[model samples]
Target chain A: MTLVLESQLPLLIVMLTLGTVAKVRTVGSGGEPGALSRLGPAVLVPGRMQAPALLVCAAGELVLAAGLLVSTHPFFRWGTVAFFAMSTYVLLELRRRRPDAGCGCFGEVSSAPVGWRSIGRTVALTGLAAVSVWSPVTGWAAAAGWVIAGPPPWYAAAGVALLALLSPEIEELIDRVRYRAPCEQRHGPAESVTLSKLRSSGTWRAHHQDLVSAEPYDSWRELCWRFFAFRNHEDDDVVFAVYLSGRRPAVRMAVVSREGSDSLPDYIPVSA
Target chain B: MGHPSVERRRVLAAAVLGRTGAVPGADPGDEEPLRAVVGEVLDVSPHLITIETPGGVQERLVIAPWATAWNGSDTTPGDLSVGSMVLMRTLRDGRVVERIWADTTRITGTILSITGKKDLTVELDCGPHRGHRSVVIPYRASGRLQVRHPQFEPGYLFDAIGIRRDGASLALLPATSQPPYPARSVPPPPPAYAGTLSRIAGTATWSDTFDEEERGAAYPMLERTDTGCPKTGVSCAGLPYLAVGSLLQVRNVCSNRSANVPVVACGCMAGRFCDRCVECDTSPRGRIAELSPSSYVELGGELIKGCFNAQIGLG
Candidate 1:
């Protein structure tokens, strides 16, 4: 029970810090539009209920943080478990729905995407809460007193908690450092006006459903190109290539028939 | 978000991305007559040189009669020999070599002084030449050079493209600014001023009116008023508080660049910006003002490089 209380002390501190950050960020700027927009798909929180839901979530975190600090009862431990479970569920759902959306789990400014690292952190916290629930409550109270009474020890514990909370961000930073390419090799121009115009065209809009999954062509050619893999109305998977040609910039579409198996032909002009 | 901290974080992220080369628009010319090829010289002659490209292909190129070659400072075709490394640019014809640099000395730096519009000096912070260098922009070359910003104020950084003329001098050449392809449509004017009229500190972005292709008339040009007097200022019909001809001061907080500009025309045309000013506002997210390309450049901002964090004050 003593060992369990000791371990849980650091976890509680980390959770308390994270909860405070989440609460402040949620209530910050009136509300975080980027986070709110992503909430609907991740948590089933509807657009109309986003404001109220955010308030409730933020307030709940604050209450939980305060409760954990003063009490060691089974109720608070169970509450920690429940809170961590909900967080893990939300993060997993976010990872599944919109892998590109920032977690907004820690703070509004953190643009880190929800990934296995976030899930792992949540799982670790939930495990700590579950373990602490089984331990006796008497030692937990004494440990909290020690953490508050001793300044040096409290500083050490706070440092450890901060490091634990920042572990995921550090991992992400390492990943970026390992995977990013050199500047000279990766630099390039922005999206061309021709591609922008093609995207805005009526024909492209009409077929946007099909072209949404298109991949841009990677070559330096006279024309800009993109390929789409989409299902037609008949539910048959069709592959086609779209080209933006001419100095004036015009669009031309070509369907690659499986039966024909012919290579790409010369540009077939299509009016915008 | 409305929070100033959030906006600052977003701007800081953009600045970091720009430094990492993650942001696009660094490439000056997507479409130009000159084609660059880097390779090792296998055989050399006065008129022709054979070299192997990195792609493992052997190619022969014709040397132009007036082709200028620079090894470190300046060199002639006679200096080229076997096993020499070179980066060469040739005309689209593939036969006429325009310029070749054996060891190029590129400079990215902040302008320290300007003698006039034709000759400005810069203090190089990056590249092999890491010191002050005088850049001579000839009158003929000025029209074609794609300077990131219009106003050559001290402390504005510029990525210079030219060959080394001497240890402390680089002869400036006109870098390409045209997009790979011409713009298909003219971008509509900026959006209506829906926000309140106050000292708004937000990101600043730029747009240009030097349309060599001549797609549309230059924006915010002077026009004769109904009262028969010449009027020049951005139209501000939608913004009743910020009336037309109102003077506004825009400052780039990051580079310490500032300019006092007048409202020539309203951001909105009939009712809205061409496309909500999405096409014109090149600044990062949470942009506040859209300056004319010249105005943006004059305020020490880059159109292609995207947005710079700025503070807009109503003067």
Candidate 2:
């Protein structure tokens, strides 16, 4: 088991190096300024210290990568474990705060939100780092020797490098395949009576001022339903369930009152 | 060793499937029925013509005796010669040239003048006829031209794909241009939200052509169109960054009207919209999100007003 896990060190080293380069480039380009700014708050850095915080983050990534590559000492191995543990924490916090925000972990190349896949990847890296602590190989020299004199030839290094380069793309592809709806299986027609149609309705015009926000209620169903929240216009919070249904394409709207409870069933249905 | 009858059946099956005797599993149906190749004629003979494609690949194709040829207008095969830029359509065999249009001229230049609201006087700055040469683009021919400009004006660059007519003038056909629409200025997005939601403010407008036309061009990755997104697809030359399928919450800045409209088209200056008059700027700021006419009317804005100021937000 140790030999099998130790054999993966070359691939992990390549992936970490590639990730470090990507982070350095992203910091230089300021591609995800929003994500970078949020990082300042996540790590308890001052808001005004965004630039220095980003530099520190980049430098830390470089150090982690260098330490993983050049040293097999318990300090470097433990440092790797701590570094990935910190990364996993920061990513989870960012995910909790801004679920829609780009992870910016691999830079501008990926826009995937920090989700289970990212956390899973970090956990895997942490496990790998822990394994590296017990392994005899230390530094690029030993790893290179392993590749040259080991069972596999130098061509295996090229394959590992190629796989490392494609890691971000593979992650993005996994996200797309997992989350994106297939074309044929889409819920409904591309265009439905959305807020535009609601505003066009006579009932909507009369109650326009009481409007608050239009939130999509359900996406899994064949028809996408949106809940339009409105303030108390006639002494009650108005909730409008607007969606397109039936064969002959028409906008269906139902008004309800939010008297108590946050559930949809708690709202009392009212006619428009 | 197979039986004689089995061997005969196999041979019969191969023949029925249109497989060549020399190559097993090769399907004759794999050959395209009709395909086009554009190149400059290097050599021409009664039986064949050798041409060099734009990619520097030289190909020699056989010309069928019954092949039809046109150079701007209908012409005999005898008229085809060296140095002619030809667009050739070949049959399934690939060797037989079926139809060929030779010396088809394509020009990219700025409009020098407009005559009678139809005819255009263009100064050729690129293509075969370079160096400020004036060419008259007739009104009758302009109708066939696929122009995307918001307005026709001088100083706007155009790409005219047509044939050179009599007297060195170009009979313009399908064409595209980069119209000059002032880029709509967009305000900087708001600071990152501590929560899971973020919002920004922008204006909204409407159009009636949403359902009838293909909106896939605006968001090429999201929507797929059969007729080539950038060419025969809808104009997304308004806001290049806004994808077609994105949903936005819009609230009227002046009135109490608000709605959620999915972007069905891109109004950015691209493709056909690129042909608008030179007055419109093609910058990335001051962008407009167009809506369906019904959407506009529903948003409590008059149709005649064309556009209304509204705060648009994306989560």
lDDT of 2 by residue, A162-264 (tens): 4445345575666656655332123233333445555565556555565554432221111133333344445344444444333322323333333432222
Interface RMSD of each: 22.7, 23.5
- Candidate 1 chain B worst ten-residue window by lDDT: B209-218
State which docking tier applies to candidate 1: incorrect
TM-score of chain A of each: 0.50, 0.51
Stretches of candidate 2 above 4 Å error? A1-5, A32-47, A150-272, B1-315
In model 2 chain B, the worst 10-residue window by lDDT is B213-222
- Best by lDDT, which number? 2
> Per-candidate DockQ versus the true complex?
0.01, 0.01
lDDT of 1 by residue, B234-276 (tens): 2322122232333456766655656555444333211111111
- The numbered model that scores best in TM-score is 1
